[model samples]
Target chain A: MTSLPTHTEKKLGLAIDLDTCVGCQACVTACKGWNDQGYGAPLSDQDPYGAAPSGAFLNRVHSYEITPDQGAAVIVNFPRSCLHCEDAPCVPVCPTGASYKRVEDGIVLVNEDACIGCGLCAWACPYGAREMDGDVGVMKKCTLCVDRIYNEHLPEEDRVPACVRTCPTGARHFGDFADPDSTVSQLAKQRGGYDLMPDLGTRPTNKYLPPRRKDAPDMSAPLAPLLDIQATGFAGWLDKVLGKI
Target chain B: MHPAPSVIVFTVLSGMGFGLLAFLGAGLPAPSGWAAFFHWGLGYSLAVGGLLASTFHLGNPQRFLRAFTQWRSSWLSREAIASVACLLALAPVALSNWLGFGWPRALGLIGAVLALATIFCTAMIYAQLKTIPRWNHWTTPALFVAFAGAGGAILAGQSGAGAVMSALLLALLLAAFRIGDGAFAARAQTLGTATGLGTIGPVQGTVRVFEQPHTSPNYLMREMIYLVARKHVQKLRSVTLIGAGIAPALLLPLTPPSLLGFAVIALVHLTGAFAARWLFFAQAEHVVGLYYGQR
Candidate 1:
């Protein structure tokens, strides 16, 4: 049962735009808020008010200062979650048949009932996608909001993943990637979207549109005139006197 | 990567237990009746006790039986099946030898192979994780089997084979250190690659973490990004080499042939092996740590 499906009916995944993301963490917040009430077990927090607090979260925003070839250090907010990879390494490593990629949609999920909480699936994942719920004693991962996507009761426009729907900057986009012409796929193609650790060969369904480089302002260019000013006034005479020293 | 004590007990205790089983199944110093009772009893106690210890870290220990369902695709599942089958195969031999009915040499031989295979499966669990570059190598499994073999031979009272295997273990330990020392660097996965900045920042200037996701450490950071004190680990490595490898190789041959003598050597070797395994988990650098700006 841990064996991965060779093909999914629909590759439903995310295309995160690094360019527009402002590191607001709204997606992270929205994800946590929605997930606490929906789906499997509640994302439990250990020692919430204590000094050393740690919790299980399906989505997280990590900030980085990357110095590009042509730009000043860019601060890119990377949202970490389950990628729902095509060759998902996390699935087959599960001793219990808890971790699996859906055949209908490419989303990877954990069946809490079956999970032994051994954490091997978490170990096998390269993206740090899965986290073990210490309270429930099961592995929890990004379900891509499987409960919400096809919910007939919800309004049509409010049906995407919580993170994608709540992103103020629209950094997260969700669509059926199995269709090449889908918005997520087109955005990926146009922006040169890439897989995280492609060399690891997970063939991740989610793609990241790289942070676009901005030309760095030359540090010396602005300072040259101030450092090499023409002394032409009484103040300049003071400069001449100081030069002798 | 946290080097959980439960896992340490499981790997060290069970590895030795199975290793001892392999030797016992092979008919080394064949003991029967009450003598066989003590020998196989120790083997089962360690093996079963260690297996029980493994459940301590699990979130859902009650659901452990489900682990047996996925052996076709899971190494962990395969390990569960193999270990149980091995104990069962050797069961007939143990019962027969104890009752003075028969030796069951053929069944014992089959059990011996299964015992080694169980150890192999256990090692493969760690070796398969590409995320931890330090453990993702052939050396991981090789080291596990080597330690098991050396310790098992000694426990079975085969001093000659134990001494030679101990020496080989020392060489393997050194080689493993040499290769594993640079394993993380060899992967060349910087924070740049981890965050998808490498494509734009091809020159690889500097990609430092400006801010972390949370002020407090998260589960991933705590579970996967353990940074053991390098000084303590270096000292422990010396202890492992001397106590487990060199001391066993040199002293096992000279010690008078007696149960107490072999037990002393085996205890020393197991202690050293415990240290080695502790270092193995503590020193490993998981690739996910890169995201948290950890080595």
Candidate 2:
């Protein structure tokens, strides 16, 4: 099972927009809530109310504050998850046939029953996507909401991943990337969507929309004098009031 | 990468075991009767015991039997297969030698080749990982082979001349491994490349951790973001070089050619090998560490 298929028919993945994300972490919580009770094991936490609390979740949002010397300051909220790569490195490294890529939808999944929980797949991944569930002794990752996405009981609109549905700013999009005319594919082409660590050749299925630069007012030009030092306080106040009116 | 105790024990002990088997298979004179039994017992104890120790590292040790089935793709599985084959082939030879009638030379030759192949497979498990910049190199397996050969020569009571040659080779390989490991640069990916922010401007400009997603250490941080202090690392490197390389090279040559001398040299060399293996895991910088700004 570690030997990858020649090609999967459909590449179902997420396209995240960096420009619109607010770093609210709603998607992270939603993913935990859904996966905890659904599909596999619960996203268990140790000492939740104690001083040191840690829990395993499929998604995490990292905030980077970029203060450039000359350009405008940019704050980027990067949400990290499994890109579900076409040539997933995690799959081949697994000793047991636990880590596998789906032939149907191209969704990479871990077979908990077959896993020996060696943690080699985690070491193989360039992205910090896979987490070893200590409670159950198996690797856990983003299933792309495999349970809910295919369930007939769910509403048509609710068939998407929990993370995608929970995104407040609509930053996350889930669709079949194989379809050239699909909304996800079109958005990727239009916004110049790019892959993370393209050099590694994992060929990640998820695409990230680069943050657009905002045009700032030019500071190079000579500034107009705010107020003449020679002018009286009363005159300056009157000028400011007249300018506002 | 954390220097897990089980892995360290497995690599060092198993390396010696395979090394002894390789020398034995290469026609190191098979001792008569009880001596042959004792020799075979020692080799199996080291090799099989080390292999068993490695299972402790797995989260689900009971499910380890399934690991042998993925030999088609997984290096770990290949290592398992090679190791089992080496043991099986060597066992009959050892048994025949114990009964005072050694097996044919061809069978011993096959076992020797398999023993070396087992070590190579074990090294490949680490070397094949593109994620770790330090371990992804040809020199890693070479080091493994050299260490195993040197340890095996000493453990098997090889002739004084052979032991001296192995010690010298070990020294050269250790030096080469150190230099190569130091000189190699990580050309694959950086924080800028990982985030796709390098396309916009300099990635260095955007390298700041505003906030972490979790307050406490998560599994990723514990497993991947291990940090060994520079001072400690330097000290350990010196210890490894002296214990595994210089001391063995010098002491093995100078000491009287006796079982006790060989035993002393073996013990000293193993200490160095252990230190070296620890450094192997500790210094390896995983690409995922870049995501956490640890790079």
Candidate 3:
């Protein structure tokens, strides 16, 4: 019989509350700042002040405008990054064992020393999570701030990932998903959180809470009288020329 | 998706190597004396070299033994297992020939079967990746088989008459299959409207990259760009068709008896097939690229 470790079955994950998120992009900046300083080489840019400036970043925010017929403008801001899946497609596809999921903590990591800059892991990922560091020629992604999470020097509150810690709106929460009583698990259950692209079957550990809306404001009410057309000297001439009341 | 060069080289080289071996072992006439020995030796060496090169793509070389365990779910695992089997089968054939024990036809046949199986497994690795719709189709495996046959024919043409006709036939079949598949893929507009934006209408918006998901270029963009233009593809296809297919066909019937015709055919086929394989990877598109704001 094949023997496998039962103790390593527990997986930690993240719960992101979309309703509470203010889209500050604080987490994005924090993640870039931390990752650039730790583990791999710094995220270098080709031209810091040029027309076509480009560099590496682990997290990014996507803004979308959702216009419903009965409600005010609902702007949805989605922060995208690696989900740190239970079945990470990027890990095993690595021809070099440089990309691997830790059997202990379920963290997917790339061993830069073993990597030949082949860039196969990046191809395997559906999330667009992994990025090739041009300077180092090795692949890199969100480590979930592995070094800080396990460091004994840090306090319990500050032990989470830099992105989670830096989130100003308390939208991001991280904990062991295997433990039912964990805050992330409880929040997910109460809020009906969902994984992005669940059809891919990656079994991503991170979950996103659907955007919720309160009662819509009444738009059918009669409008107040319009402002005077000739209130200002420049406005009177412009309104007359433009044929506005 | 990133089309790692080592992997591309490994698949292309081994496809030719094992392909030639299998074709020879499939009852094609064997060259006599040192010529026969050199042909078999070189083909096997190329196959083994390709396999070894693939190991560089792995992160933990020591744990490679574990790859064979996941054959049930992973095509990659199946490929590893099949490659090992092919190598094992080649051992006896090589041994018998070197020791002057016997004809070793039975061992050769076994090696050939394993080699074909390995090529199939390698093709399935790409065919099975659902993320890449272009590669996931039936054409992928057909392309693999065709390329292998084409490569084998080239080798046979180089060695002697035993292979000339067979190589010519395989090259013709591969050329036809690739051209047909490319045309079919070009016509399929399933990818254009799958995102639920609308029907297969012309793009109306000024679809520029307003803001990317990340500041850095991610894996999705790098792997699935499939950046080749239609004009370049047409040119490459014509070149491959002539060099890998047509030239080999014409050369097989024209050259004087001996190995001269075979050598010319083999050289043309190898170069042509390499170009074809490069185009194969360069033209394949991934579904994830749609998310990168690419049409």
Best by TM-score: 1
Candidate 3, chain A: TM-score?
A: 0.84
> Candidate 1, after superposition: displacement of residue B192 in Å?
1.2
Candidate 2 CA-lDDT value: 0.84
Error of 3 at A199 (Å): 1.9
RMSD to the true structure for each prediction, in A, is: 3.6, 3.7, 7.0
Which order, best to worst by DockQ?
1, 2, 3
Of 1 and 2, which scores higher on TM-score?
A: 1
Clashes of each: 1, 0, 12
Q: Candidates 2 and 3: which is better by TM-score?
A: 2
Residue-by-residue lDDT tens digits, candidate 1, A1-245: 89999999999999998888999999888888888889999988899899888888999898887765654666778898888999999999999898898999988998888988899998899888988886887888899999899999999998999999999999999999999999999999888888999889899999888876565567757767778778789989999999999
User: Model 2 residue B252 lDDT?
Assistant: 70
Per-residue C-alpha lDDT of model 2 across residues B225-291, encoded as one tens digit per residue:
8885634877887778888877877777678778888888888888888988888887777888877
Categorize the docking of model 2: medium
Candidate 3: residue A202 lDDT (0-100) = 75
Ranking by TM-score: 1, 2, 3
Tens-digit lDDT string for candidate 2 (A1-245) = 79887799999999999888999999999999999999777878877899888778789898877666677668888999999999999999888888999999999999988998889999999899999886887899999999989999999889999999999899999999999998899999988889987777899999998787767777765455554354559997897888799
- Model 2 steric clash pairs: none
Show the colliding residue pairs in model 1: A137-B59
Instruction: Output the worst ten-in-a-row residue range by lDDT, candidate 3 chain B.
Output: B196-205
Residue ranges of candidate 2 with Cα displaced over 4 Å: A221-245, B159-185, B201-205
